[model samples]
Target: MSDAKLQSVLSSLSQVARQLEAVPSGRPAPDASCVKLNTNENPFPLPTIIMQSAIAALERQYLYPEDDNISLREAAANAYGVSNDQVIAGNGSSELLGLIYRAFLAPGDSVAMMSPGFSFNRKLAMSQGAQFLEIGWGEAHSLPIEQLLSGPAKDAKFILLANPNNPTGTFVPVADIERLLAQSDRLIVLDEAYVDFAPDNGLRLIDHYSNLLVLRTFSKSYAAAGVRVGFGFGHPEIIGRLRNIQNVFNMNVIGHAVGISVLAHRAAYAENHKHIKHERQRVTLALLQLGFSVIPSHANFLLAHVPAEQDGSWWQAALERQKILVAFFPDKGLQNHIRISIGTKEQMDAFLAAARDISGSLKMPSARRWAASGSASALRGR
Candidate 1:
């Protein structure tokens, strides 16, 4: 094939990639010498026992992983109080989402999701040629469940609810979710990636609601983001359909072994959960005292509003200079806000100090240059 023909084939493969490349990288400012809080990761390292278990699996390096990953599935099923047949594990919850989409979404089928939610859901829906019906979460970052059920778009085939939503950290109560389940006919996919840190979890409702699928990840609570182990529970029929669409060797040997070890030492993971819950509250309080308007959160991060004059682009740029990174979005309603992941107490102290320093310097004329330079327009156009 000619070079131009190859280029055309690759271009047709993904137009979203072209659009993504045109936008400026919106990553939190990198920290060369400061505490990192951009990603919502556990500040504490994984326990020694878990590492040893993963190392033990390496001894069987010559053998391929088990086709069904039966041991890991059984452990996960026991942990969630479900039958092994109802559980499906994947490289991450991200892959689980893809499997579910592949199983259920035909081209032109519609999926409903909340706006200002996780960007991955929107991307995944569009990639499948599925129409995304986004319901905008207002100032509170709460899912408009009633509007979703009662709106003209009630014919949506699938709905994704990110409890303790990303970039906003707002949660929908179990009562509200039950209400939604009672009223809607759509398959509800609840992304419970952050539920380990929340006061309540959705595992209990899986058996009661046939249409509900709850996704959990070891990345958040198990402190194994690098290992890439995630599982979802639902009706056995739904899980079986997803399993049919997944690759044969989806779970690597090391990850499956580590997952079993983590399940066995559930108490240690519980302790880590207690520590994170405590620190999350402490960080929220500190940000509130600093005069930043913080959205109520039950997760390991906080969504806070900085000054709103020229959106939050100015504050984002200032933090980059201090090597204190946090997530910021330039969407219409969220333009004045940034999301800060809760880290160790020491890390939180450093972030607060950096925030004070940045606020103090904002009065200077030179500090206002980025805001004046049309960064808002640049962001919007993208």
Candidate 2:
């Protein structure tokens, strides 16, 4: 098409859509041999019963999945101790987050989230022509209740808080969350994607606060990232509105079957959860010993400040050279930090070995030159 025709066609798009450029196709996925510790995924296999359920579901490939995910929602309701009407199932909690943005945010409205939180919300808000406000966490990464209540966030359509927050892996106390819920009239969307790895959760607050919506996913803790099962629990009215706008047959048969089966046998993954926590601690200590400052993590990942000699990207690139993949954030205040998802013992061991090798190579040249110049001898004599 001519530029004139393309311009005319583009003019027909909404202002928001017109303002947003088409996303570029990114690079191909990493090599299979690379140790992937970038995205926080549970590197474990599904229990035998759950695998059997997924195989059974494949046999029904010709049939449509349950409408509105009724059976799966019922299973989640029973498992989480909520009424069926108060639940809404989605392909993933990410889908539910999109629904919340659609249902609550109009053009020119605003939403607030705890800063250094999930960065995806900014894109979601922009797609709706809504303002995205980022509120910083208080000292020690605690909830800044007064700031959230009295700051510009006071007028936001809703507040988004991720317990055991992403990128930082810092968890806020449930009592502090309850305090905020009690004072705020705005809808509070609590993303608990990593809660199973944390000590406490805010699910109980849903009963008392009509404004609280808790989101959970089977992707992280349940080792079903490929299956894409997630849920939202809130007041029946809120859930109903989200469900009304959700896509028809949003999830497939395998997702539905695996979701129900997992809920029924959640206890089966106790060892999986325990192993991640163990690895998280082990990695944290190892990073500290290597001259990286690691924040105490409650989630299945750790955020570490790289050594003073190099930035996070440098470390990330060096690790990639060793075929170990980890996450690096370029956002302000995060440029010096890298996040690593806790994987199995073998993966963590490989990552640690790579990190140590990188650290050693960095120090070797300086040590060699200084020693050759007799600087070390002079310092020792002094």
Best by TM-score: 2
lDDT of each: 0.79, 0.92
- Give me the overall lDDT of model 1: 0.79
Let me know the TM-score candidate 2 reaches against the reference structure. Answer: 0.95
TM per candidate: 0.88, 0.95
- Leading candidate by lDDT: 2
- Model 1 residue 137 CA deviation (Å) reads 3.3
What CA RMSD would you report for each candidate?
4.2, 4.8
**Backbone clashes in model 1, listed as residue pairs:** none
lDDT of 1 at 182: 78
What is the C-alpha lDDT profile of model 1 across 1-382, one tens digit per residue? 9999977976886554444433467887544786667778777787999899999999987888888778888999998789998899989899999887778887788888877777777777776778888778744565577787888447777888888788778787788888788788878888999987777777788888988999998887888888889998999999888888889989788989889998998688777788777877887777777668888877788888875354566666667667787877776778888888888778888888888765655444653634644343323211
lDDT of 2 by residue, 179-284 (tens): 9999999999999999999999999889999999999999999999999999999999999999999999999999999999999999999999999999999999
> What's the alpha carbon RMSD for model 2?
4.8
Q: Give the TM-score of candidate 1.
A: 0.88
